[model samples]
Target: MDLGVKVDNLPAEAMMELAPRVEAAGLDEFWLIEDLGLAGGFTQVAAALERTRRVRVGLGIAPAAVRNVAYLAMEVATLARLHPGRFLMGVGHGMPEWLSQVGAHPASLMAALEEVTVALRRLLDGEQVAFHGSHVHLDRVRLAHPPAVPPPVSLGVRGPKGLDLARRIANGTILAEGSALDYIGDIASAAKGLDHRLTVFTWLSVDSDGDTARARLRDTIAEALVHPAMSVQLRSWYKADLTDAAIDALAVAGTPQDCAAALRRLADAGADAVILQPVRGAESAQIASLAEDIRPLLDAG
Candidate 1:
């Protein structure tokens, strides 16, 4: 089973220990959230690269509004050169508030993403693109320090339109773990000939106190739980409520056995790998238990 962690991407001191430990756990990748709440995505990747060798580090969907493709392409090229096969970039329609904070909201998300993606590729392939698209008009857009071999690009999208875009353009997609593989069936089939990596994030907990675990997770991931895409889909499938508190309460709030069952469900949903997010404020005992005590169950598939 391919496993990874959803790290806070803050506190450089934390990565020194966490990075090596995650690598030691034999996880396949480390996906970093832009701790715009704390630091930039590039800084997090740099810190992680310095600590681990084999485990890949993903700048997991840095805020699209915060970065232009030109700046992002350069940083990605630099990281690939520095870390070789150890870095990937995931970009997407970011937090709504964060986009407003930057004073830019390109009306057509699909067009904005498409333009940036095309321009970034042209630059990375060692070509200067004089591309003028509605969202981004590039005249002298080019990369001088492009890597000999560029890093792979990933996108995060939930709807069919975005999924189709990922299928058409990106190497893969990075996602917060979600179930309902059937929801995006045609999108994945569209990805048949290409190598589109699916990295799903799930907040996992395993303990006897199912109520406490669920409560803690409710508080930690409340915002995400009620996100439009997540809640809308959940409500369609189950009796899951769409309100913030209710959906949050539903996020991975169960016993280790229960959480394991859920992961199995998601894997069967067509996830290639799952990045487990441990519940917030969990004790060392809990962390240790999750890491050492829980044996792998059968493949969810």
Candidate 2:
């Protein structure tokens, strides 16, 4: 039940300021959205690292389609070097539109990701990656300035095969299936009792104003409009009037007590940490409120 929250908006100076407040709240990590559409992930990460002292800063899975395995490994290594043990990396196969928008070829996504994951780890170990892989290779390249201590890796996966890949390769696996707890058993079982962390990402809104919470969720839920798997899961879980065909149940919008209670449910289910991805128009007050309220549940559990 560790509380981790996403950071998408805030001024350059405000980002640095965000670190102290986030740390003060006893959050396990600051999950920065390396949102390509909004800002450079590295840019915000550097700022977060510079601004915070002990709170770990993690990229919320930089799209593997956006960069090659070599550059990706270098970037994460650089972040770790800059902040020492305070840096972490995660990777995800992003949406088709974002992949196409960047003109990055992401076809055969499963194969592509499998290759990327192995190469990145090799580079992190400061070894020359000489794989003759289809998607990624180092040939003779190695990390010039590698991390003194290897940071952790988490996979952003929603499907079965992706979950299996995570179990095979990553230190931990993350689930973002728009609130469907149906797959937790399948995902957990795949881990085979490996001492790996499990994370679940969901939309979390907390305010006394109920209508305002729902209003904020509408804008955030739009992406599910085009994703069927997400839509089906949401419809099955809470019977939400899930209009979006694509978006699953990644978001949870409700009053403070209700949201807090739901977070406890995730911990009770199996997640070590619950990443709070607030959709459009989310505010820091929600986090501030959670720090004031929900943390006790985790400690008690």
Candidate 3:
């Protein structure tokens, strides 16, 4: 089980500054996101890869509707060929609003996702593909230089049906932020009988004092509060009285021991990898603690 950090909503300059530090810290991976109005995922990852030799770079997801499947295959293959086993590329049905704004949202999102996954997998495998599905169309395309060992294509998705689709077509699934242990269990159950990797993001904040660490996670907690899925899980799983103060308890925040316990719980609940998404302004410290303190604890246990 690998432990990693997500670099999101941060400036490119800030990320570049952090990349070498993340590498020096002995972190397993540093994941990036390609949101509607932010830096491009692949390009940013390429820069990180260039800056670091040890830390693997991952794209949390690229929207399947935003680009041609064949082209995406080429991009991922080129990066994999260049970096070998150091890149992880994922794709998904993007946020509906982002897709609609870009005029790329399909009428049937599930169909589109399935089409893209199937075609992308074939292309990555170095096969000549001529796919004509409801959403994706290709014309006998094949990568001239495919990866010798293709990186797993993960589907960034949520809900039971989405998990099922990912298990059927893609090698892995990326759960959205705020997914709890029970939610991960549900995904694992749905993916039973299939060999699928599960990578989940959790809100993270680590400080020497528990109170300070919890305080740093307020914004992340507030963001999770609005998520309908997370709200439901918090209510059912914790069965806690949902107070403002109590809500902060949902995240992996507190002292190093506390954070390590939270991570162990998630790994026990069936996560192949857990990417800690630190709140803005707390990334560097949280990442350092993740590698230096939390991971050593997990390993020792």
Cα lDDT listed for each candidate:
0.67, 0.71, 0.82
Best by lDDT: 3
Give the TM-score of each candidate: 0.83, 0.86, 0.93
Model 2: worst 10 consecutive residues (lDDT sum): 242-251
How well is each residue in 42-107 modelled by candidate 3, as lDDT tens digits?
Answer: 889999999999888999889988888888888999899999999998888888888999899897
**Candidate 1 lDDT, tens digit per residue, 1-301?**
5667766634657655577777776667887777446667887788888889999898877766556778878888888889888897888867666666767667777788877877777788888888877777777877888888878888887766777788788888765554344543344556666788776766766667766666665544545545565743344434444343343333444666766666565566566777776654443344455555443543322
* Candidate with the larger TM-score of 1 and 3: 3
lDDT of 2 by residue, 7-59 (tens): 67655465566667788888878877666567677778888888778888877
Cα deviation of 100, candidate 3, in Å: 1.2
Model 1 TM-score on a 0 to 1 scale: 0.83
Give the CA lDDT, 0 to 100, for residue 87 in model 3: 96
Q: Which ten residues in a row have the lowest lDDT in candidate 3?
A: 235-244
Lowest-scoring 10 consecutive residues by lDDT in candidate 1?
244-253
Who wins the TM-score comparison?
3
Candidate 2 TM-score to native: 0.86
